[model samples]
Target: MVEIEYKNARVKLGDPDLVYEPAEDSFLLADAALEDTESGMRILEVGTGSGFVSAVLRANFENVRIIATEINPHAARCAKKNGVEVLRTDLFRGIKPRSPEARFDLILFNPPYLPTSEEEKVPVWLNYAFDGGASGRETLERFFAEVRAYLRPGGRILVLISSITGVEAVQEKMEGLGFDVDIAGRTKVSFEELVVVRGKLS
Candidate 1:
């Protein structure tokens, strides 16, 4: 196990196969978390990975209930270490908003956005954290299909996308789902530009 400090939170990580170590994508999501913190706000973070973003959310919000979901068992343990309630399941599989009387105020996801072919698929679980499948939209397509049920009437979602993931397609799918999509934040590195897209019910 290795301990790394992310933002203002101390996180312990072990076995990369079991969990996806937080990276630039995770930090970008944390930046989005900054704007969503509100007293008693109910938040759900899908793909919690190393639990870094969940930790950041819990630390920054007041009376806000945060729920985390990670498909990886090891990642779920890492999230639990951060002292946040976690559900080990696929994105939004079966989780209730922390506020029972209402739905989620904000839903955050940093999904697998890398386009990978079946030939590149491996037995490693970490691949699930980065492989977005043929068009890099496989996982996201499923996420968008079910996310609306969990969101409040005016709730919002923040998701990360890479230039390689085809941002235009993602925006279109979101728009088709009745969301007004906008880029909330963006950054450029050597190979590609990373974008944080915010979607709200129109």
Candidate 2:
């Protein structure tokens, strides 16, 4: 187990197969979520690997109910340990409380946005956190497709994306989905430009 300090919280993460470490993408997503959410906002974290950001949100905001979903068993356990009310489901599959009151005001995801070849992909359980398929939009496309079902009337999404994933293509996809997309934040690393995209239904 490794204990890492992220933003305003210290989180303990276990095996990588279970939980993703706190990396640049994680921090970027967390910062954007914090900026977008307020006390009354209802939030849902799509892939709460280590539960760090959800914990931070719960700590920083009041009267805001935050729930997280994780597909990996280990990650789910880790999230539970950190006080996240976790749902073990693949994306939004099998989620409970599908009522309107369960609709989220904002959703956050730091999905696996890195482009990877077939050979480069790892095990299913481990790769879901980082393998973004040949174009890096594999998981992203799925998220954008399924997200509309869970969003409240004015609800939106803040997701961490990358230049490597074809930024223009992502934007085009968002437009196709009837969402007005904008860059919430971005940081350029050595080669890839990591971006946090905020999208609302148009």
Candidate 3:
């Protein structure tokens, strides 16, 4: 297991080779989410690799309930080790709110936004962390389709998208889905800019 500290929180990465390690995109999303997080809020983090973001929030907020989902078993284990409540399941597959009251106040996702070709794919579980299919929006499209159902009325969503993944396209898609969308934060990386897209129920 590997441990790293961020925003005063210590996170562990169990089997980094198998799980997605926290990187620039991860830190960007965490900082953006922290700007909007409030005490006593219920938050759900989809695809919480290594639980870095959620762990940061947990350490910084009091009375905040955070739950995370991960498709990778290794990631789920790593998140659990980092003191996050995580479920090992595909996006939203295992989360079924018993009532509207159980819905989350905020939802966050840092999806795999790389435009990966079949030839570029790896033969390990880590592929799920960086494989966004040919368009780099396949998994994100899936998330947009189902996320609203799990969010409470007026709840917010914060998602990270790279310029290579078509940030404007993502913002337009979210708007078309009945959200008031805007760019929350952005940072330029080596080859592309990472942006945090904030969407609110309209």
Least lDDT summed over 10 consecutive residues: which range in candidate 3? 93-102
Number of clashes in model 2? 0
lDDT of each: 0.85, 0.84, 0.93
User: Which stretches of candidate 2 lie above 4 Å from their native place?
Assistant: 96-101
List the RMSD of every prediction in angstroms. 1.9, 1.7, 1.0
How far is 43's C-alpha from truth in model 2 (Å)? Answer: 0.8
- What lDDT, from 0 to 1, does candidate 2 have? 0.84
Best by lDDT: 3
RMSD of 2: 1.7
Error of 3 at 151 (Å): 0.6
After superposition, candidate 3 runs with Cα above 4 Å error: none
Please name the candidate that would achieve the greatest TM-score relative to the true structure. 3
- Ranking the candidates on lDDT from highest down gives 3, 1, 2
Clashing pairs in 3: none
- Whose TM-score is higher: candidate 2's or candidate 3's? 3
User: Model 3, residue 142: displacement in angstroms?
Assistant: 0.5
Candidate 1 C-alpha lDDT tens digits along 122-155: 8877888989999998999999989988888888
